[model samples]
Target: MPMSALRFAAVAALLGVALAPAAAQAHRSWLAPSATVLSGAQPWVTVDGAVSNTLFYADHVPMRLDGVKAVGPDGAPVAIQNGATGKYRSTFDVQLASPGTYKIANVSEGAMASYKQGGETKRWRGAVGQLATALPKDATDVQVTYSSRRVETFVTAGAPNTTALKPEGKGLELEPITHPNDLVASEKARFRLLTDGKPAAGVEVEIVLGGVRYREKGPELKVTTGADGVFEVSWPEAGLWWLEATVQGADASGARKSSGYVATLEVLPD
Candidate 1:
């Protein structure tokens, strides 16, 4: 299966999975590394991948490794092996040699079905395979809208590199002002969220340290963008962190759609 196909599979599978207590507005894909900063004794690291509505939880389904790619510390291609897909998440291991930052990313893009009725518009919840068959047969205003998605994470061996974590100018991208791999729990970290290579204001960003989920009423895990589309948050502790943002816009077909971006940051202990 291809990257888009695998993502669709995970989305379609969500209809069958039990929903969490708090349902997210959209589904996000993520790549999380086992160790953000490797030591001399540790020669390898592992990554977990999944596409689900719930952040940091494999409640829906695991992501496929059909088109996964990893760049080593020295910007060389790293060979990923022993990839295994499970019911909830996918796991892969990467060997570490050089002493810098390693980046692992996944990209998925395809068309989505949308129903435009009057001023109100709604998008299909699942895969494109469930298009008209899963929707009402009498539906008249169905539009095939295009969408692109990308998710990435970083890990450092000895020192972190800012050049390696540069944004790829995707739909929703995070340009880290502070090094993602070298974040400390006591200090605040800043990031600029960009949409189509430009700063996006008023974007909803969810920052979670550890496994805590984002809630609208909670101030600790959620923050919105300002005029510069920049936000800073202090890490509660040192551990694995997940940051996700969502934005809605019209596709090339003039159909209203939504896209999400997820990035996993590993903060060192204070």
Candidate 2:
């Protein structure tokens, strides 16, 4: 190969190595709202859910709607309308009955176990309560892991409020100091990470702008929570962005558990 060809190959090899970790996590799950802020007597917002290599592109698979839910500004359960699943994405709509913010999320939790029964290894996945019956009576050397995940977005009918943004205190969640629907480009926004309702410190969060398919590389920002579980970011530009984080610890019963949180935020131009 010519000297120029050799250099190009070397660069490509290095790039691949650097991106290996990212590729492993390339399939990102998110919920995208058509509009974050709205005004009217009755306002409605449509949302799309998908798992894709590029943010909000919906190329991989549709996110299941079984775990999707919504909360009104008064902390009441809001109904999802016109929910449908397609080949690459799931679609749903929420009507803003009251003039405040609404929280829409897809939440899921489950446990996995591996054990030896009759000198054979077996694995089981289901709700934690079913472990007793799912595992054989003679099962030995059992190990169980619990996991929880939440993907969320915010929509405001008139003004944003904190009622719907309250943390459930049971899993990984985002407590926004700056309203999620009020993000502005070049302005600083602060958020806190929580695990089981308490401050989660030293957690790493990955933020990336949407429309990755249109660019050579998507712009990404990485931030870590402080001792108080707070992190700040100044938006580089105006667009839809995705933020994700994960934390691992033991649950109340002393079983290993992992929790993950993902949010899609829309930033407005300043």
Candidate 3:
């Protein structure tokens, strides 16, 4: 199945085989930046967030900005300005006051559970902390799953730096072997996949370019991580690209947990 389909399937199957690979869904979520690299005393980039049937095209619902955040080169929180939601998409602006890279992300974490209460099945979804109190005290045959998801993009003011790229050591994350803002067509870019701070080998990554609305069929490229949890991609041309990956495992409490990551990157002409 296409990565788009897997996203929805993963959520619906969270209590079953959470994060299991599945077919494509009708919509895909993404974040697109107006610019990935800039030069000036202070630069800014506008980002569009949406979940559309066509990649990067706002033909569907706007992505919620409640979890959106930005981090500067110094590992300090950067402010997101002029955030707004429209009919089909959400827009936000970030100021590149510092002369280095910045990471902008929309993150969400929650737990899903199903139980039998009063001889009826009940379903619940909420933050991990609220799982305990939200569920019935006498609920039987209870099953729970935790999930984390992140959608993000990178922008550089002067030169790209890694400080903002540091992983939080939770959920699925990208560790760039090749700087995200430095991607070039025909040149290979390497990245490592991490699951709970450790290498996540055998994970599959799906790459697709934007402008699918104008094409008869969108082409998707797939790659799998090696033992080192690293994978490489050679861009076919210059444009905005969407990459996604998902992994499932167990949390500290031995409860089933899953993580999904999506990133938008720009590839420059060779």
Pairs that clash in candidate 1: none
TM-score of 3: 0.91
In candidate 1, what are the lDDT values of residues 71-91, reduced to their tens digit?
775566788878999998999
TM-score, model 1 to reference? 0.73
What's the C-alpha lDDT at position 20 in model 1?
A: 25
**Which one wins on TM-score?**
3
Query: C-alpha displacement of 212 in model 1, angstroms?
Result: 5.9
The 10 consecutive residues of candidate 2 with the worst lDDT sum are 14-23
Candidate 1 weakest lDDT stretch, 10 residues: 14-23
lDDT of 2 at 117: 75
Each candidate's lDDT (Cα)? 0.69, 0.84, 0.86
For lDDT, the strongest prediction is 3
Of the candidates numbered 1 and 2, which has the greater lDDT value?
Answer: 2
Residue lDDT tens for model 3, 1-270 = 112344544655532235444214556789999999999999889999998888899998899999999999999999999999999999999999999999999988888777777887667676789887887689998877888888999999997899999999988899999999999999999999998899999999999988867677656789999999999998988889999888877767767777888899999999
Checking candidate 3 for backbone clashes, the offending pairs are 4-25, 5-24, 5-25
Residue-pair clashes per candidate: 0, 0, 3
Error of 3 at 126 (Å): 1.1
TM-score of each: 0.73, 0.90, 0.91
Once fitted onto the true fold, the runs of candidate 1 whose alpha carbons sit more than 4 angstroms away are 1-29, 51-60, 74-76, 114-142, 212-220, 251-253
By TM-score, the candidates rank as: 3, 2, 1
